[model samples]
Target: MKDETKYSQVWNLDKLYPDGSASTQFLDHISHIESKVFSLEEGLNFFNTPKEINHSSKVADLIDNIGCIRINLSQANSYITCLLAQNPQDQNAPTLKGKTSSISARFDAGLKKLQKILVKTDHHLWEDMLDTADLNPYKFILNEWRKKADMHLTDDEESLVSDLMVDGYHAWGQFYHSLIGSIKVNIQVDGERNELSVPQAINLRSHPNEEVRKESYYALEEIWEEKKEQFAKILNHIAGFRLQVYKKRKLENILEEPLMENRINEETLSAMWKVVSKNKQPFIKYLNRKANMYGHTKMKSYNFWAPIKNTNQKIKYEEAVNFILEHFSQFGTELENFSRQVFNNEWIEAEDRPNKSMAAFCASFPISGESRIFMTYGNRITNVLTLAHELGHAFHNHAMKSINGINRQYPMCIAETASTFSEMIILDASMEKAESGEEKLFLLDEKLKRSVMNFMNIHSRFLFEERFYEERKAGIVSSSRLNEIMHEAINEGYVGSFDNPSIHSWAWTPHYYITKSPFYNFPYTFGYIFSLCIYAKAKEKGKEFEKDYLALLRDSGSMSTEDLVMKHLGEDITSEAFWEKGIELCVRDVEEFITLTS
Candidate 1:
């Protein structure tokens, strides 16, 4: 008999739009966006003249008003993204998502016009404008505009780039996603043949059963191998479009744009990678320990994410929430209280269903000051951890609810700080209270897995992209070459720990295809170690650090990455020693795991 329990398995879309994509209210919102984009585009023409920056009072008001409108636009887009993630098969949702994409392009074109004016502003007047009531909150972004302004072409050319990007660059990313959604693999689970979405098969790579993991891995590779050429096209076209853009902008180094977007200098990035390179040995030791426990001299790539101790412990949904909240309360009531509200408010979609995305995300509605987390949950420990991670993002957004929308545009480097930090709070607390060696080892694997992922996995992604772009400069890279690059990246990244590597990972991963965030890689390591340093401080300072921590999250968008860290932690990001402190913390975890397992 089926259980009669009616769990809040799906999030409430009524608050966003009563009827999802078909909602009359949703159509009204889309129409409003179309109209607003037109009006904003026309009004942005006031800044066509370079001298307008010095004289126009309209610039400040326009900036504030446009920022306000962007919040509503984001709310609408968030709804569509949630809808699409829930049901990629929905024909109506795709059209609505495309409308949002078009609106986004027009919206970005208007911002470029505004950026051109800001670029041409006199330094003294720009400083004066930052002090104005209307634009004061947007100082950091305004300054960033002027600092990176030289890369821009003429205003019209810049606008054209944004417009063409709608169907040109971003469309490739959309294409990959659509393809992935339609893909399915046939496999046997529990003595029964089953059909699974690409995302579902990928998730099984973490399954505790070795046969299941191996079967899913081979099935995944076969499917991805079949479609390698099309995947290559997606990767090539996206990188090709970017390279051409950089060429037109006279950008010499491909990393220049990603570095600039991340609000970090080459030196800071180098320092982080330097520390990561030095710590690779420790991570490999942890990996070897994991392999030995599973009776393998060398682990396969599919087993990399498999939990140790042969455990497939299921953590119940409500139990996971209570477990997270119990640990979260140790830090402060506010975070705990906010998390509770999120749970009770049905702000999460955790239904375990086919055709749903495997990845988890926390999307904030800037206008409503709320956030919704999306994921495929199966009451597993991994699912609980993912819930905590997304909830951390939600809490971060909640912390900044009082700030203006424009001021909340933080870079990707600092974006994962809260989410990673939140995970640690639960992990550390759980480890401290574990009853058995196996239980502790299981938790140890969870912690060490993250360490290796950030230290090794993300580093490989960074290295792969760095090399890919460098080689791509010569010509379009063939599918075979992409595999070579991916194989090399994986081999070097894992330090030869795996016998059979997941080389086709290049096709299965979405981060490489994200057009907006070019280098969607290093920031994971940055946020990981950076938050380790923060977590260390919280340990030393106890509850005293919570207030400053929340304050830091609030100020994440309003300052340089270095300045933000210095203000809260008095650390210099450019220095190697600062990153070393955090990496050392990870090293110590590996050391403890070794001792415990021995």
Candidate 2:
């Protein structure tokens, strides 16, 4: 029966596009946007004052049209990408990839022209037009633009910068992506031979066999070590490019660019991590005991995910769905019904297959007013957690469904809030229902493993990015220098207690220097702990808090992370108090695992 099920069985593309003509509609819509932008530009010339300008109405209409165009374009691109990922060797996939990129470039040029005109407009005039704009939806976006006045360059200069950005910054990311995806790992498991992709190889760390775990770790390191120099070159080039941009803007701190883009204050981030660092004693102790349980005197990177005991657990997909929906019902009717809708409506694509998109994510389409989940569910306990996590994202989008078009795009810092919160609920429920000591210990260890990876592993990478940019700005940081900096960051975070002979080899993972999202690591920890705080509230307040939680998700796109925390939880984000509280909640699970193991 398990073998009979396939990954393709879970995908429902009909919700995204009912027919093939949708691509034509999408092209026509974007073409019309290009035509209207010319008219909008001409109208701007007729107005002497921004207050007298009727640019608001036109801008609002344009924004809506653009949003629709994006959603449709994304749907088309995603469909093709998913198909291609399922079978890259498909002859039609190559043409689709080229066409997708060409379409994207054309759309990018149009946006650049519009941005050029907007940047040329007088600030006060633009403000007045924004205030007078009939569409309240665009007010937030326009205000954000004005806030970034310092970042604006001359129209031609900005266009040139944008053009350079694609080949320079973006291409670096593309290169790294291709490099990582092409790499394969071969590990010897007992008498058998095993081969896995990068993600799958990483997942093997959770396997119970100590030898298998060690073999997988060395296999990963071997592949990465072979590519280390070229990988370092890629990292250096990307960081160098970013530093040049920062230098051009005269930004004093390298972190300033991503902080601005994240719509967060540095004080808030520092405060959060400071509390996280201070609370590390509990996690350190937790790891020590967890290591002892696994019969290791000191934990190695290989044993980081080693199970605390035998679980022998399996969750069938249907049974997993029932468990998710049952726990969600405790939140309220909205979540309960939303889960049902997601499962019933072809919103999810959950099946494991060879050569599919390697991970899971939820994408919301504004025009279609729907969400699509993409994953290869293997009927593992972890797979169920993935579904619950993605559904949380979908629930977040559902909360924003009635909001204006421009406000739907949330900042990355808080993007994982809903998803992690969902994971907490599902995991907590499973722990509560565990029938044996070992089962409880296994669940508890899994949760702590997540916390450790987020704080120590991912956070260390973020620190490396910061230092890399700082050094790169002064001059190009050599490949050796990059690895040295990475080693220091890793030692500062993870190397303290672990007596592992081999280091984590942080240079091998490309996320540290990926240009797609610089400083990409800390947010996971933030979201992880932040969701814990929310989950705590949900547990205490019961169904009553669900409304507030939904409201929080709806406002996430429009507000700063600090404001979101303040508004939803009434916690001061620039202080250690809230973070301390969050860390205490994390330690509770650690404490429980200790008890379960004893």
Candidate 3:
């Protein structure tokens, strides 16, 4: 085994702040933002008059101030979040979290006044504001707010809801986060007693040993069972709070906000799922093959990420970096250069250590034009792919650095496009480099694993959330009901793939607990297929497609998902034909896996 320490590097936060999280400068910046928010609130009182609203210079100045405050607040929040991710046990992290949350609340409270003014302003004046040089960059953002302005409550009511959320709605999410981060599982593996965090135990699902995987699965199930009720309450409360807010805003569809947030319509979402449902049979075939590889009559929930076979070659961290860079260079010089900068600057924390957060995410700091990636890397090819995945996010961010802040915030649907595209590049390169049949089979399995996940596993999550939300509208869903819903969704998507379904699946997913983004599950499937289609285009066009791909990434934040895809790919997302193309690509991979393994 490679020394895990050699592969790990503590990311540098100096770019965000010359001093770390506790730096005096950071605190002073927060105080400055607090004072500015108050001043902006006071200034909004003058902008209510028609004549004052038409003063382009004055309105432009106010917009600039708001933009500055938002950028600074984002920078500080990113710093604290980075610190917290690196050391979840940090005593000061929670305190800073509270402080930042309050600052955000205050800022939102102040922004509501400006929004109210815009809502009441004459349409002609609004047009003038959009055309103003200072405010033109934010035209898209302002127009979106204008579209929803009528649905908004009075400023006082909105402010009340925002403040209450700090303690009420959002607190539930925090509670869930704390519970997962602190929970420990005790399981006996190979005649030795072992204690693991929730994340560490979950990682064992991919372990090579069957007994360890089974033990870890049961241990996780037991722990989740014990907390099922609490998890249920958290989900209900979060959904309940959202429903209440939506009702007050006069919104009917629970999906309306998420759709708007993702910049896609119901037609597009429906089309994507229709194509996915039709393509599920191939994945089922792959699952059956996977079960045979494991010497089982049928697969189980624990077998989802299980390694088909283990290779003796272990990829070191430096070797992984080189491998990623080499493949990326084949695509474009820009991609390779960006990956090198990430390694040289130590922008990743991939060490295997205790108490670190579970799962990997790439966080981009637009203010500093940089990104930070968090993941625990062991010497595995999966780790190499993960590194490429995150670097894809950084590369996307790098492309968007030139855009204004408001335009740079892409929705989650398109957010995974670049990352998934990067994974495709890495997978193809690995398959080409594999020397033996066993190695080729292993690599093919890895590629097929993602197809299974995006097509079947994530489809299950989407079905579960859709049904849960529909049920939640009537009344509070009991724990048993949640389990039933989850089981039905899993069985529907994974039909005949699992001998026994995971009923407690709903209890452990952190996505259900996110208060800011509701119905966050389907975006993974959307991004995956979307990226696959883009990757196929790149393959057909050779190096010529690189420029177009980068252009798509740069424009991702500025337009709606439909518009972005249509502009770059000339494909309408609302059409079933467009989605079918992506689904067929996934099916092709499954067929290839079967051929290689057989």
lDDT of 1 by residue, 32-104 (tens): 8788778787787654533433444666667666777688787888888888888877889888877887787
Q: Which candidate, 2 or 3, would have the higher lDDT against the true structure? A: 3
Error of 3 at 300 (Å): 1.3
Error at 40, model 3, angstroms: 3.1
Give candidate 2 regions above 4 Å deviation.
3-9, 18-55, 85-100, 106-128, 133-137, 501-504
Tens digits of per-residue lDDT for model 2, 1-598: 5534222346666445443234455455445544544454454455332334676676666566556555556555666665555556667656655665666665655554455456567867676776664746476666665556556566576667677878887787788878878888888766688777788788888788989998998888777667777777777778777666666667778777678777788998899878776767777788788778677777777888776777678777878888999999998789989888888887776766675667687877655677888887876777878888999888888888887656777887788988998888898898888887777777787788888877777767777777877777677676667667877877667647566523336555656656667787777787887888898899999999998998998888887888888988898878888888778877887887767667
Q: Candidate 3: where is the Cα deviation over 4 Å?
A: 1-8, 49-54, 128-135, 352-355
Q: Which ten residues in a row have the lowest lDDT in candidate 3?
A: 1-10
Give stretches of model 1 more than 4 Å off.
1-9, 48-56, 131-134, 181-183, 223-226, 353-356
Which model, 1 or 2, shows the larger lDDT? 1
TM-score of 2: 0.90
Using TM-score as the yardstick, the better of models 1 and 3 is 3
RMSD of each: 2.6, 3.2, 2.5
Compare the candidates by TM-score and give the number of the best one. 3
Q: What would the per-residue lDDT of candidate 3 be over residues 309-333, giving only the tens digit for each residue?
A: 7887677888888889888887888
